[model samples]
Target chain A: MREIILSFPKQFKIGFKAAKGIKVLGNFKKLLICGMGGSALPGEVLKIWLKEKEIKLPVEIHRNYSLPFNVDKKTLTIIISYSGNTEETLSAFKKARREKLKLVAITSGGNLLKICKRSKVPLVVVPKSYPPRLALGFLFSSLMKVLTNSKIIRGISREILSLESKIKLKKLEKEGKNLAKKLKQKILLIYAPEKICVLAKIWKINFNETSKVPSFYNCFPELNHNEIVGFESFGKNFHTILFIDKSQNPKILKREILTAKILKEKAVESSFVFLKGKGVLPKIFSNVILGNWVSYYLALEHKKDPLEEKLIAEFKKKMKV
Target chain B: MREIILSFPKQFKIGFKAAKGIKVLGNFKKLLICGMGGSALPGEVLKIWLKEKEIKLPVEIHRNYSLPFNVDKKTLTIIISYSGNTEETLSAFKKARREKLKLVAITSGGNLLKICKRSKVPLVVVPKSYPPRLALGFLFSSLMKVLTNSKIIRGISREILSLESKIKLKKLEKEGKNLAKKLKQKILLIYAPEKICVLAKIWKINFNETSKVPSFYNCFPELNHNEIVGFESFGKNFHTILFIDKSQNPKILKREILTAKILKEKAVESSFVFLKGKGVLPKIFSNVILGNWVSYYLALEHKKDPLEEKLIAEFKKKMKV
Candidate 1:
């Protein structure tokens, strides 16, 4: 688990190179990226990036079976399934093909890859064997490359190159270990600025799957409207973690600080984890790395195997997935 | 709260009538519904309705300030703020105007209404004074009428008319009251089918604000991918509510049943709250009404004032919103 976390940044370059020749032909009006679990994470990251760059294309992530109701001929649907076998993604891929929409598929090796090859659909196959959650670099970069090659978005070569250098793992590992100590036996409530709320969700998912603990997440401004009231009645057993980005809107930044203060007033333990780095990629990837380490260390603190998702495996077997 | 819940269905007819003379002139390619808190619930419900009817126009709900990156002149932006003063929705409305997108506004009475009236934006003003969360019938039906008026979607007048008759408030209130008794002193984990997961989120919000308790929600299939593991290590003090819609994909129905069985195996107390009626409007509103009763009754059980969001009120004052 530690090795995978340490080498995570290296996947970006490999992923970018893997999709060099793959592109879907379309004057796409919108994008529908379909995936489930970890594969869906990239679609979300792309959305934040698109918004940050002020890209005009609307991007929607479909995490269920088939396509969204709004999908049309001008939609470029990208199917991402790390294992290429995710039932939902496969269903979406089949539907996209049936609809005769331009399609792209990203996977390591599964039925998705084979079907895409057989159907002559464009695809990028990443390195196999890593858990989908830990394969973000590969899935995200590959998806971005496909978008770039398709002329849907400008190239992000500089951002992709800086990831490995921008992310400092040793320091984050130490900080994560310390944070994990405080989080021991406590439920987690993660909050992030609305623009990058997906990171908060990713962190919660890590805590659940890695630490085998219950964690919940919501974005700021939105959470301020209703979720903050949840603290009015109870707080002792829950720890609030705020992802503070210096680059966010000042009003939003103020909301985060005030929300933390109110939670403190309600006797809730809270931590403000400031996001580091200058560019959007580093800020995002840095948080992702920190979360990976936090969940990894928290798993060790609980005497659980971070790499083992026994319950998921069992549930999948029962469902015949 | 009881009186409001009992008469909730009646708002549908009143809401539909409120927008009778309003219409935006344009060939809208998409719908951008902007609002926050309870105001955002209507947009989500509309997305589900659009999907059920397979409407091709993409509808995106923006819960934060300004506009999404993809908003353009071809987008019909609907600003819904039950209080009309919601800062986020207000910001979105202003952005929509500045961008010169086709505009429609829905509010009881607030700054949003004033701005729209002064700016000559087509608007719908519903009855005032209900908490935005309980004002769903007004906001939802009114927004639908705006879409129908603009020819964005087919008319839903028949469905709107059936809401009051189809949702049996007496039966749902009784059921909700009984469910609240079982949910007392327990944290809630509400799960719904992925297609209408918005209902799960609305249910969570009701519990958080009305019942003054912590509640979290996620959808099926998606939750099966990661969240199901959280139950492996913890279950006590948690009550899981499953919103079972008989009309969902058979595969999804199977997943929900299997998921509940797994939760029971993990010793988590589970309840299957079947959604009533045939049409989408009734199924959704019935669940909404039931949630209102449960949250209202739960507040009574805890001696908490269901209508008072003291924390939200205090926080907003601190933020000076």
Candidate 2:
């Protein structure tokens, strides 16, 4: 797990290389990303990134067994599965094929890879070793390369390489440990602005899978409209971590600050973590890397194996399709 | 609150009348509904209803302030705010207007109505009095009528009217009271199939607002991929409500049953609420109405007023925008 965390930058380079030779099919009206669990997280992050970049093309993230009704020939459907064996993604891939939508596959080698090979769909294969959740860098970079190559968005290869060189993992680890101590034995309620909402989700999933804790997230403005009210009855059982980006709309930032005040009044402990980075991708990945360290420290505090997903294995065993 | 619950059916009739005379602009390439909180719930319900009826036009629900970048003149944007004063909806309405997207407004009366009136946009005015959360019937019916009148979807006026006549609120209240008794003092984790995921979200929000509880929801297939694993460390602190419909895909149904079995093994108490009704709308409404009663009863158990949203009021006062 530690190696994977440190190797994130390297994964991006490898992902870019793997994405090479894959033909760009431009003029697509829409893009659909199909995956579930960790595999789906990258697509979600990319969706937000695209929105922030002001990319005009519509992108839909599908986590279900069937594709959306409107997915047609003009739609570019990207199927992602770290193990290439996720039932839901395979099901969606089959449906996408039947619909004859333009298809691409990202996997480390499983049934999905075979299907892509047999069907002549372009494939980007990442090296397999880590759990799917730990492979975000590879999965996300591959998807980003596909989007850039297709002219759906501009390339960020140079920026990614620079970010890799600039990131200081030791510093992140120290900060994560400090925060994890404060968050120990408390449920986490993560909040972020709309543009970085996926980052909050990543934090929640990290805590859920790594620390084996029940953590949840809600985005700003939207939460201000509804979930903020529910905090009135909250007690000390939860601690909120607000991921604040300097670029957030002033109104949204005010809402987040006021929301923290409200939660404090309700006796819920909360703190703000200002995200640092210039570009959207840098800011998102910076927080993503820091979240990994926080969850890792949390796992240490809980005395649990950060890499083990026994329950997930049990679930897959029971799942027939 | 009791009056509001019983008046659900009557609201549909009034809403249908209110929606009349609102001209529907046809030939829209896509549909976008912009609203937040209660107002947004109806759009979500309508999206599912449209999917079940196989309406091919792509419908996207936007809860944020800015319009999607893809919203061109051919996109039909429906801005709904029950009070017509929700800041986010107003923000989105202004953006949609500037983009010259086909615009429609549904509201009782507030800034949104004024904007629509000044802009010469068609408006559907439902009656005022109840809180927006309690105004789902009116909002949903209004949106449904717009789709029907626009030739985007077939009219369900007769089916809705029949449902209004056949619904037995007294029986639903009794059932809701029984369920609420079991659910009191416990956190709720609502689950439903992909087709009815929005219903699960509604239940969570209803619990959050009315019962003053910290409730959350996830849909099948998706939950099976990640969250189902989180249940392994589950204690007796939470209860799961699986909203099951017989008409759901067989594979999804099996996953739901297995999920329930796994939860039971983990000592997480769960019960299946088999959705009753032949049509999608009827089944969804049945669960929605029942959820209202359940939350109301739960509020009574918590010694709180279901209608009093002092915290939300405080939030609005603090929100500058």
Candidate 3:
């Protein structure tokens, strides 16, 4: 597992460096940060932090191979790839360029970098070192900075100053008592209502990979209709139903709280984790860092390493993917 | 359960009524259907049939209230509501109106019916009876006819003619003599590719409500990424994998077969249901109906009625939805 973790860092570090070099934003019609796979976690982290902030323009994170067909000149397309070589990002970049979209790019030295250089696009070139998954912080921070510069939303570096202390290996080990211990008997059901819900997915994956437990994520309004009914079958299998609650709509919030109470009557176990967020960076960073805590504690309970996904690498290799 | 089964027909007959009046789809940019719950099943059926026929006109199915922020003119929006009302569909109808999207509707006569009537949008008012779940056929046939009239896709009159007798329910009843009894001893996994996978999901749901068994659904490519590893974990637990091999790429088909072999090697029970589709409609129709047959057989094995989902209805009442 350690060897597997070590191999992806080179690609990730490049993303980190690029994030550090970005100019902050102050305002925009819309902000869309596009990335996929491990590289996209950073964009997701940014979304979690911005979960509560009042932003005028919709901040979106696109993960698919093409730009949103709705996007136009007023939209800002953030082309991101840790290796600067993701095919989907490149395809979207081409479309964004064709649409004359306002663009910013984050990547290492690869096709993405070359394209950015050729086109004179705002490029954040990171140090080439780790895998995209590990470099989540780097990619996310860059996007966060850019959003701040555009004034699409405010940045919460001061609120998240504690983030620097919390992210380290030693701090995670010590703060195990502070965060996610509340989830010991809980089943984490993450909610991200924003377009793409990048951070919400990250919470689910981390719960699976780190905690080795069944976890799920859903975008808002969508979950309101079908999955809510699914709770009827849960019949007390879970101790807690953690809503990665973010402020999407006041009406939605009221509905969600009512829905939670309704389920508490039937669920064998139920609890809510009201996530605390400040700005785009802090809100998302807080969730990820807190998730990291909860998952690690869960690992301790199961007596398993939080880092182990015993068969994933072997499965990937066998698939020849 | 017996009562529920008897009630499906009345709800389904709404389709026969809806076929009476509908608009032609001329100068329409694309067709998008907005539906949720039981009504959505028919649209899924139509999409798979269309794809099987290589019908390539862009068709979008909105399973939620919000349209993908990109839809616009040249787009035809279809609102389907068996009960004549679905909140998400209503919200979407409003959006479609705002976007000036061409509108055609299918409903028994609810708010959606009233709205369409007051407006110039054409409405195919299906006779509303039975539970929406049982009315899947009517929606499929009516939508197919409208799309056919617009030259969006070829007509399915022959397909409808064939559907009357094509569901040789006894065929699966025979398969049950051998395998259905064994399903009780293992976990059931259902696989379907994106194009026509509704049958796959339908199959799983039927298993859940009928046999009351645990089942899982994995779309291809995505499954190739994560769930392939899950099969390796069963050192001793009884498990079964069902591969719904429909129209998949040869390479992908090979990958699925290989996955089955690997599961078998890991001491898991697995079966392959090789589906032969005469055409797109036959393939989609046969698989969906096959799902109904499989559920019946499994229910018979358990001495349970295939139509018992009282809990699902009870849930709707509790949610006040």
Best by lDDT: 1
The fraction of reference interface contacts (C-alpha pairs within 8 A across chains A and B) present in each candidate is 0.70, 0.55, 0.07
lDDT of each: 0.87, 0.82, 0.59
lDDT of 3 at A259: 54
What does DockQ give for each predicted structure? Answer: 0.66, 0.57, 0.12
Q: How close is candidate 2 to the true structure, as a TM-score?
A: 0.95
lDDT of 2 by residue, B230-310 (tens): 544444667899988887788888888888887787677887888866677778888889999999999999898999888
Query: Which portions of model 1 miss their true places by more than 4 Å?
Result: A232-234
Can you rank all candidates by lDDT, best first?
Answer: 1, 2, 3
Per-residue lDDT, model 1, residue B236, is 77
Alpha-carbon runs more than 4 Å astray in model 2: A24-27, A149-154, A231-234, B24-26, B98-101, B118-120, B231-234
Between the candidate structures 2 and 3, which one is better when assessed by lDDT? 2
Over A1-321, each residue of candidate 3 has an lDDT whose tens digit, in order, gives: 334222222323333344554553433566677776666676555544443343324556665456655565667778888788765578788888888788888886689999888878888876665444545666665565556555655644444334443334444334443545555534556655544366666666666666655454655544544344334344354444444456554444554565566557667354555555544444555555555566667666667676655554454455455
Model 3 lDDT, residue A318, Cα:
55
Q: Please report how far candidate 1 places residue B201 from its true position, in Å.
A: 1.1
User: A48-137 in candidate 1: lDDT tens per residue?
Assistant: 888788877778888898887788888888899999888888889988888888888999998998998888889899999998999999
Worst 10 residues of 3 chain B by lDDT: B4-13
Interface RMSD of 3: 6.1
